[model samples]
Target: MKFALSLLVGAAAAQCGKRSPSYLTWTADSFIEHGVEKNFHYTQATLYLGYEAAYELTGDEKYAEWYRNQIDDAVVLEDGTIKDWDYEFYSLDDYRIGNNFLWWYERTGEEKYRKAADIIREQINRHPRNQAGGFWHRRPVYPNQMWLDGIFMADTFYAKWTKMFDNDNTTAWDDILKQFVLIDSHTRNHTTGLLAHGYDESKTAVWADPVTVNRDSGSAPLVWDRAVGWYFIALLEAIQLFPESHEGHSILVGFYKDLAAALKKAQHKSGGWWLIMSEPYPGMEGNYIESSASAMFTYGWLKGIKLGLISKGEYYKAAKKGYKLLTNRFVRADDECLLNWEGTVEVGSLCCNGTYEYYISIPLQTNDYKGVGPFMLASYEWETY
Candidate 1:
């Protein structure tokens, strides 16, 4: 039955002028064939998210089966506790893979997965927050800071958990909405209508403005494309799980629309976005099209359209173009048939000054999990859309 559905979807995709070779499957297969890291990192969770999407799109059990085994092996222990789970560090990035825990619980009625999820939820409940009530991106190391990346890492899982376990808790719903509102208030770029990479609420970080926490004062010198990409997807994820009757539903939807419009305007002519996404500055000469963020934005736009948050007439062409450019420019095949994604900044963080040079100077990597995960996700969204 799954085979028949695949064939039918394949034919429809071909009729729609989709790439005949199934980039989605090839990419997933390549990642699997090459082996993946066994860690509780957000990058691995992102690829898992992409696999879940592929399973949904193609009705392929292999995707789900592989994901379940990976989670069992790398994350959950036989005792139902997270393997090597650290309660002291309290990193939001670590909470992301817990989404898979909820996935397994929903499908198999397993206490082990739900037990692991409860541990993560407990950590999040106690996770440190800045003065304005944003989850500090991480504790101790990135003290009193909230990076846009943290939104996608932790909040998506929080929203899903709230929906599944505590839907009637108005406090949880309001807190979820407050996180988005707080970060947007701190980091929004008025000129570009985009948010900066992060904000330091205590104003102690080197990049933070001592007096005012706006980008102009060096709180976040420039907008990083991938950071906004994270924020964009996080908004959509929250909106999907928020009930329509919830007072925060329309507020999150409004935020999603505003960010979508801003990102649409920021799309480059090459159908990708630059490492430095904001206006041209004195040192912004060498900004080039980036892959991970492009893939993420493409996924966000396509998914937003799928959810009916935005009109297809206005955004479909942009998303379609972004997907085409992603394949053409970044997705590469080696002689071994393994896929490699190029042009992803190795790391972008508020640990530095958040300057244009800091972002552009970051090293590029091939098959970096960050790029591969999002590219896989974008391909699946494009195929299914």
Candidate 2:
């Protein structure tokens, strides 16, 4: 009787605190404010997505306004170009935030927002590509490189951009399709049906294959946590953007669903994914269960299930368990606040890190943005469904 009463009380308490996830509740445990080397982290898209999600869930005007300000701040006015990017040395990673501009433009009728998005999209168009029609991750500075992580970094943003204003641009659609084709060609390992961490287009870098130019960066070669997270999220976002009439929509959705199934299979039983996804030899450095990647997988699975791309029974249950483990052990939550998220989650690389220790060795810091947006997104999905 006592146990039942306690359970009831706990349940009631949970109900009382249940609210759709809001970025307002999330305080950056560490901030890049005041010129603190902000460029080191991939900014823009993920951060603005947090604010956009907050606006959607809470109807908070402040987040919407702040996001608009961020886009305005990032505009680059060099010699002759009114651009949102420095393409000579830029990565597709930053443009993901461009999706927010369209929504803001719709809300405010601001051509500047639309213009800013156009500028970014144009930058994507004008940027250098490798021999096979794939983007060169950033500039030649990151020469001969194409990380699996780069797929979500730009392509999802590209799809959203196309959805917004390129309904008539057949060439734009062709470009988007080509981008995916290039990624599928470079990263997809036909044997395991998983992505390698990245590929070196030139095969010249130390991490590159001297023969094929692919990055033989990690062990197992099954999949990596963060890299796979990028793939799943890209599929989810891109699928959402796909027009119903497109012949490829169903195919992409099927791929996403299958990827989710594969990911569920790879999830560590303790409710996370290993740094290196496949079962590994005993001495791998960072192959243990990782936090951000686990949270991302949980977010992806929950989002996929809620989006009707996957079944709820198993995916939902797994997400719930993963959330529990994250909140109970990995997360430092007090009074509805989260702290100490694992900041740098990189794996499937034989170079710098691929062992369980390397994954865990990336310091658990307060409110890293990598986990923040995804956790908030997952929580919002939880609240809704």
Candidate 3:
């Protein structure tokens, strides 16, 4: 069945005008249009990262222009301050769009972009952390907890800031590395070699495992595909910014290799990953292949292979299968050129004991930024390959 799906995808690619279909091209426009209609937020910020990748791959000004306009709209004050941004909330999610500021600064040498990024850097400088030194996912609400999602939300941008602007500050490197190491130490399930969705240092969240606190630590119950997906992609992004001679660089590479191995094992025969990745045993209810996470893993694998962080053969094959499954099974297009990528869970969080039911209960959404962003990113990487 998987082989047949791969062949269909290959046929689709060949029949399209280019090596790949026009999904990324059309979807990029769709996402940008949606953002224009709605206010720009962190979600749109993330989608722009994928669009930025598309811009790099094709050098299309439309993609670049869309990103610039989105950033411009978000950070509108003459003084280069972000409009309507709430610094007091200290939510890691709010900081993701700062990545675009950094991107623009590097591209255009614009001081305004740098000034805008500084706002996020100041937030990170004062953001609270757990007992083990991992940043809290959010202030006041998710205290003493570190969600995998926050790693990408804050650290990727933080790492870039350190590399680009504060290279002389050696302690920034340590601060950056500590989050990954601490999170992995607390969250990883040694038996499965996969980390859980989140960890509560206080062991107080209803979702945190009481027994795990006594046995290991207070980690959440399930291995969520998108949470791990965030971690995987963040590791790759962070590694690029680390100095090769730094000990932290080796630590990150080790983590990435370990995660790549675990994900390689966890990938479904369908060439995708399950929403509850570790729960894929026969007939496990709600254990189904998810599109956004699948796209994220595909992007990570292909990018990892390209960067030589992992060996190519099996990782490349798995990536190929994932890209094929993504393009064939999930992606759809209409006559109006609207693109929809199906099977994305709109929102998943570690709330109320983190039960299996809780993981599956999140409503599925189509054309969601989480799904669309990774799909664009995966498409760009696949095209490059």
Candidate 4:
């Protein structure tokens, strides 16, 4: 379960330049060689997504095989239950890796993958929800709250699970859309169109404002870029599985388009987003361009355009600009030609009033899977579409 904290030396192409498929291959190979860990967590789960995208784009069995090996070795147990996950903790973050379970199930039609995935589905059915029916991000910790990031973690898998195993369950589709609708109504700023990172529905969190803060109602104080990025990617992923004729599809599309326009406008001159996405605090020294959110937006814009949810010209320009900056600014090639992704904010949360200082103070990391995974996805989307 150990990861090489330092960059690994390896032979590969030595460029982190524009729009080449080799970059994607190099990135994936570097990660696989780094050794996928056995621990079940969002960072690794996020990277699994990049691997999934790589497999899809290149048809390389290595990418798929790497993922399959990790799941078999690290995730599922002898009795078809999952390991390294606690049933007592109803955290949405834990639900993410289940997407890999679903993917493996579809690939092999194996009962073990299905059994593992059902464990997550069972948790989702029983997970506590706020009065409005939106999930609490985590029980006991962050109670009575929902975060923009939570939707991506839980509902994307929920939508895919329903589609795969319970397509006839009409209520599940309605519930999926309700999460989006509630988060939008509660957190979105009508003027800026960006969502706050999290919302405390009971208005009990220290960060939840009693009144509008920067025009966003009662949600966590600021628009942390990666938080919004999570919601953005989730929308694209979930909508594809959503039945188009369902009434909720248009609702989700409307939410997606609004955020898309907001993100397009928020793009920094450098083709990235600030760590703090709300109005820049005057004299804040630590605010800088973040890598993961930039990569996520790049992936979202490109994927959205490919899905016909957004138009090509404007978003394509934004995606291309972001991808180029993503490569030149954050992604690097070491002496061994192994790709390194840098400048990802370690974490941002609703603690400490979700303050400007708090968001800026989080440490930056290199090869953090959160950033690495999205960078891989962005690179794949850039090359393929």
Q: Which candidate should be chosen as best, given lDDT against the real structure?
A: 4
- The clash count for each model shown is 0, 16, 1, 0
- Whole-model Cα lDDT of every candidate shown, in order: 0.81, 0.60, 0.80, 0.83
Clashing pairs in 1: none
**lDDT of model 1 at residue 342?**
72
Where model 3 places Cα greater than 4 Å from the true spot, the runs are 1-22, 33-40, 280-283
lDDT ranking from best to worst?
4, 1, 3, 2
Q: Which candidate model has the greater TM-score, 2 or 4?
A: 4
Better lDDT candidate (1, 4): 4
Candidate 2's C-alpha runs over 4 A off are 1-41, 66-87, 190-192, 209-222, 281-285, 334-364
lDDT by residue for model 1 (1-385), tens: 1001111322333444444767788778778888887877888888887787778778899988888878885688877899888888889989988887898899899899999999999999899998778899887799888888998999989999999989999999889888888888778866668887887777778878643346443356578888888898889889989988997899889888988998899888878787887777413466777788999999889988988999999999999999987877776666565666677878888887767777777778777888887887788878877
Best by TM-score: 4
> How are the candidates ranked when ordered by TM-score, highest leading?
4, 3, 1, 2
lDDT of 4 by residue, 1-385 (tens): 0111222211223343323336677789988776767666888889988888889888999888778878885788767888866888899988988888888889998888899889999999999999889998998888889999899899999999999988878899999999999888888888899888888888887888856643434588688899999999999988888998898888888899999999998998878887778875422567778889999998999989998989998788888888877766776667656677778889888756788877777888888999999888888888888
How well is each residue in 1-385 modelled by candidate 3, as lDDT tens digits?
Answer: 1112122433444454435455677678766655543233667777877888878877899888877876675564557787887778788888887788888999998788888889889989889998767899988889999988999999989999999988868799998999998888878877777888988989888877845523557888778889999999999999999998889999999999999999988888889887886644323765568888999999999999999998787788889989888988776544444555677888788756687777777877767888888998888888777
